[model samples]
Target: MTNGFCSDDFAPVKEAFDRNFKELGEVGASVCLTVDGDTKVDLWGGIADPKTGDLWEEDTASIVFSCTKAATALCAHILIDRGALDPAQRVAHYWPEFAKNGKENTTVQMMLNHESAVPAFRDPVRPGGFLDWDYMVARIEDEDAWWEPGTRNGYHMVNFGWTVGELVRRVSGRSLGQFFADEVAGPTGADFWIGVPDNFAKPLAPILPYAAKPGDELSEFSATLLAEPQSLQALSFLNHGGWNMNDPAAHRAEIGGAGGIANARGQVAWYTALATNDGRLVSPEYLATMTRVSVATSRDATLLVPSRFASGFMKSMDNRAHRQGNQASAIIGDSAFGHVGAGGSIGFADPECGLAFSYTMNQMGQGILLNERGQSLIDAAYKVLGFANNRSGAWCR
Candidate 1:
């Protein structure tokens, strides 16, 4: 633990750790803790690469996938708290063309709640589209909802960061990356970034093995729209394997459904402000609203998952997030809320413990949620805090 903060009893998680580590070919990972705003368990492990024999030391970074949306949402909330944006307002209010179709009624609330149904691009992502904010939003505006807006839920998957980011840019006069950097990350001094800049590119861990080679009977997006389904073909129109190091757009340049990147310390720092009254990047009231489940029983049509989503953050038990229980339930606190990446990476805060936890791995895992190893560390944190099951109702009391 750093500076006398109590280290969590994390060793118990070492056994299945290999299974988790091997899946993603994870090179490095770190976990940071803040109890009542104190640092603890600032731990790191793994390697920078298998060939170079470099140890996964402190300061390594990895792409965090969907977790970045929480940070992006936080940035939007800052504007809301200051009276610049309204979750209740329609998207067309900010970008008039967004009213092109039935979306004329889509609200910021629907956007955050993932109920507006513009989950993927109506048109495929093409060269220059990643950098062209106008092109993306126009598709969102004209795109027909896979399911009627607000009638049900669907994980926006890749579209959320960009949709919300575009909303942010239209309202704040800055791209989501620029606004997040200048205000949220910059002010909090958090290491997280939506689009990683070139200067920090040197430390990025390569996506291990990348997407696993597809199965011969690939359950590719079905040929016809099944129940509430958009042709799975839309995904190709979205990211289409654009997250590689050779990709020129810089991972942050386009907020993929799965591409926010950061280390553990920054993750902890970002949430500590809200949980422990530390005030790093957001106002306490904004944090409260963001954390509270705004739509409790919503089920996502896009992902065909049940979800409990707030404006932008996700509730752990909901199917709405494709990566639910695997990561969300492994952590502590019913009041706890945050996002996890495609692999074992987790970044969440438990207000009752005054705790914030973030973990990222360079390796990738197809598992929808936290693996046994990641869960073990989560269990350890709870054990250290004096809760055996951690899920027992007593801790919050």
Candidate 2:
């Protein structure tokens, strides 16, 4: 049976959550949603550790991969609201070293919108070198742009955290971890963290390594481009070696793009603050800029798919290229903005619905986007809000 509570209006979400473990292959997971600052659903179940059969608990948390990008984007918005950062200013103005390799023209806004053109380093990266922030930042600073700056958009993948994190550090004079803790999580009381503290670090659920089933089961995208050694997709994800989410060092290191650690409740609380414009993180004026569509639709250079982005979050769009087999594509109303993690995890805020939802799990799914397990819950949530029937491209303003 699924554990935790749900409001009567949200009982369908819990039903879907339970079906995930019974019918789908959910190992360990949590799903939470908040509407207009009130949490309506919270649930968790299944085995966090198959070896020991440890049941997932209320406090259990795990890596949410690229979901961290949303948190990093919030950090940038905080700086923007404070007038400490100007999105229009050159990134080099804050971090002078970033000006090297013909990147002097790249603006901080471009970095946020995935248009900065330095998605990954061309040189070989050491496996654990990401643990050293200075090294990563220096490498990115010295690396040349993969395309002309500000002309196109591409998923920054691994480099996003370092690039955004370094900008946060340079401008705020605090590490991204420290800044997030003092500014965002501390104020909102969310248990999420960019660098999971040493005290709350251990006994975290680990992401199950992805394994393909028999007989050409891997998607053509995964097989052809993401698996190819020299392709940008492979290099971006594998350059730092296979990340072990359970490692203590991984918890301590602030890989803001890929290393955010949080539970479903934590994400819900954080996004609730965003959805309600509560001013706990940033002012509502800046929140509009943060959540609004910044870049129009485009074909991502590295991901080889149509992607629409705003600041640091993905937009809900009707790109048919992104719709096929994309369980994680914008199923939420078009006005929503949030980021999905590498595996199945997804967290987003729909201001129009005053809804914030998060799903986190230890079992990694094969899809690049949200898997069936998470999508089922989202569908149930929107149905309750009377917007399941309104998911056309026009839902976004």
Candidate 3:
């Protein structure tokens, strides 16, 4: 049974949340939805640790992987809104070291929108070395541009934390984590963290990796990508010092693009702030720049599929974001924007509907984007919002 409140208007959302555990093999998860600044549904259930049989408590939080990127982007946007940083300025204007190796022309907007062509490291990064921020920044500084600046676009993956994060640090005179906490999380009272602190660390749930069954067969697309050790797809993910969600050292470090630890409540709250144009956080004009489609295409050099992105956020464009035969953007309403974690966790805001929703889980799913587990919950949410018949499946717009 789910363990949180669900208002009468969102009863259908609770039904779908329960179905995730019964039918989708959900180990533990939470779904939170806030509309017009008030929470409509907040629920969490199942075992947080199967080994110890620990219940997933109301306070439990976990690593939301790429979902962290949206929060990181917010830090930059906050600076932009404050007139402390300019998006069109070259990144080299803030960090001269970045000007080397044909990247002198790369703009802050290009980096924010994933069009800067910064992907993987030329030299192999050591395991756990991702915790060393200075070393990682040095590596990024010396690396050559993977593609001509602003010409081709690829997901920055592990590099985004340093590429854009360092720029935030230089311009703001604060680490990305400090800037986010001081400006976004603290002011808004959201339980999200780019760098997990000592007090919050205990509530962090460990992630369990998904393993394919013996009968599963790799798609030709998947087989070919894995077969090449040097493919851009392979390099972008594998080149990172291997990731371990439970590593305390890693959690304590602020890897802005990913490595964010948060719960469904925190995720929903952050987006609600965005949806309402909480002027204290983001101005409406700049928020438009954030939500507008900055890049839209079918094939990402790193992801090998159609991907849509705004400035530091994912746009719900087409089915190219599908995962495990499910529309990853299924929950996406027209013009709605948010980011999903590496696993099934998702968080997005629909301005037109004044809706902010988030789903987070410890059980990793095979889907690269939205899994069946997340999609089902999304479908139910939109149904209650009176958009059940929307063509985008779960979209409310």
In candidate 2, the residue pairs with backbone N, CA or C atoms under 3 Å apart (3 or more residues apart, or in different chains) clash, namely 328-370
lDDT of 1: 0.65
Instruction: Write down the worst ten-residue block by lDDT for model 2.
Output: 319-328
> TM-score, each model?
0.83, 0.95, 0.95
Off by over 4 Å in 2: 215-220, 317-324, 388-397
Error of 3 at 2 (Å): 1.5
Tens-digit lDDT track of model 2 for 158-221: 7899888899999999999999989989888988999877787445787897677676355444
lDDT of 3 by residue, 1-397 (tens): 6799999989988988898889889998999998888899999999998889888999998899989988888888888888988989999889999898888899999998787776887678888778888988888888888899888788888788888899889999999999888988887889998997776644667888888878665532355458987776677777878767689878889998778889999888789988777666888776777778888776676765567888888887455334334533434776678888887889998877788999999998765677788877877887788875556533653
Local error of candidate 2 at 80, Å? 0.3
* Model 2, C-alpha of 189: deviation from truth (Å): 0.2
lDDT of 3: 0.82
Mark the regions of model 1 whose C-alpha exceeds 4 Å error after superposition: 1-26, 209-248, 252-256, 318-331, 390-397
lDDT of each: 0.65, 0.83, 0.82
Steric collisions counted per model: 21, 1, 1
Q: Estimate candidate 3's RMSD in Å.
A: 1.9
